[model samples]
Target: MLLKRLQPMMFQARRNYVELMFQVMGRALQAISDVDEPTREEVRALPEGFLFEMQVMPNGPKLIVEHTGDGKLHFHGDTAPRPVDLSIQFKHMAHAFLVLSFQEKTSVAFANDRMLVDGDVSYAVRMTRVLNRLESFILPKLVAQRAVKEYPADIHLPEKLMSSARIYLKVATQFVETVRA
Candidate 1:
């Protein structure tokens, strides 16, 4: 499976690049939602104000955002000292992030066992709201662009299996669209 090849590379990378991107994007959303001048100032000050520990694993990473009374987003590795205020897990940090980027409802994915989250329910709820607000601001620009990259070489699959898989995929896609409609 492609996952077998990719999983090792993902772990070795260590930094969880995808998770870091989400943190930056999520913080931007929080900044946009700030109500008053003071809140806006607080949000502006957040780049260095909050502390977050990110851990990506077989089930994905957990993100703990700690906004100290002061203002700074202190990023920590998985083995940080403070207790986690929130945690989210997915098959990979990439999948967790794509769920947010694609504007898919995480609850549906979570219910289907595709994602898992724990710790302060209120914080999770607030995160969802923040994501919703962010989606409106980000999706339009994202969807308008095309993302295509050429592989070093074309991959070959067993002919019979490839044909069968194509047929199955087409049918499955149609079925999903029908159900959604």
Candidate 2:
């Protein structure tokens, strides 16, 4: 009796959590896409007009990114009216958040059958590199260490600090521009 009564509430709570994850991930991806030059370079391997999407199943949240150098992340309702070149879909909202929150690496999730991919293998590999670069920038070293297969050892404190500062400044500026627009 108690289980039945609690099921609906649990479902609602999970839905809310997934919605929040989508929003946060969309914004963070936008910020990273806007400022990270290396990530932009990595994305150059994609086709000239490619569209990539990261989406959660069961009608959960989604984010889209165009391959244009200046492309910013777009939430579901804002996606372009074109076919996607590649898509990475989480099996469910829980899996989406788990990967987004860095509790699970994207590659690991894919290996575990928690994710689905619709794209060319080489392009997907490049996209994974871009995501990994973004993760290195957005997450602290300690946390990122756990999320990535191998954090680069050559990035000493000085370079790391300088790049982090620049990334943060650019992300802040991008946020302001987005708000003003």
lDDT of each: 0.45, 0.70
True-structure RMSD, every candidate: 17.6, 3.2
Candidate that scores best on TM-score: 2
List model 2 lDDT by residue over 1-181, tens digit each.
9999998987778667766655555555555666656666676666667877777785676767676544444334336569888888889877876776678888789899999889887887887776676667667898877677678676677766766676667656655776898
Name model 1 segments beyond 4 Å from true.
Answer: 1-17, 33-55, 58-63, 68-81, 101-103, 141-181
Every model's TM-score? 0.45, 0.77
- TM-score, cand. 1: 0.45
Give Cα distance to truth, residue 83, candidate 1, Å: 1.1
lDDT of 2 at 75: 34
Residue 83 of candidate 2: its Cα lDDT?
Answer: 84
Return the clash pairs for model 2, or none. none
lDDT per residue, candidate 1, 5-120, as tens digits? 99888655644656555445434433343321333344343433333333445634444555544332332423445556556667665555545445445555566676656665
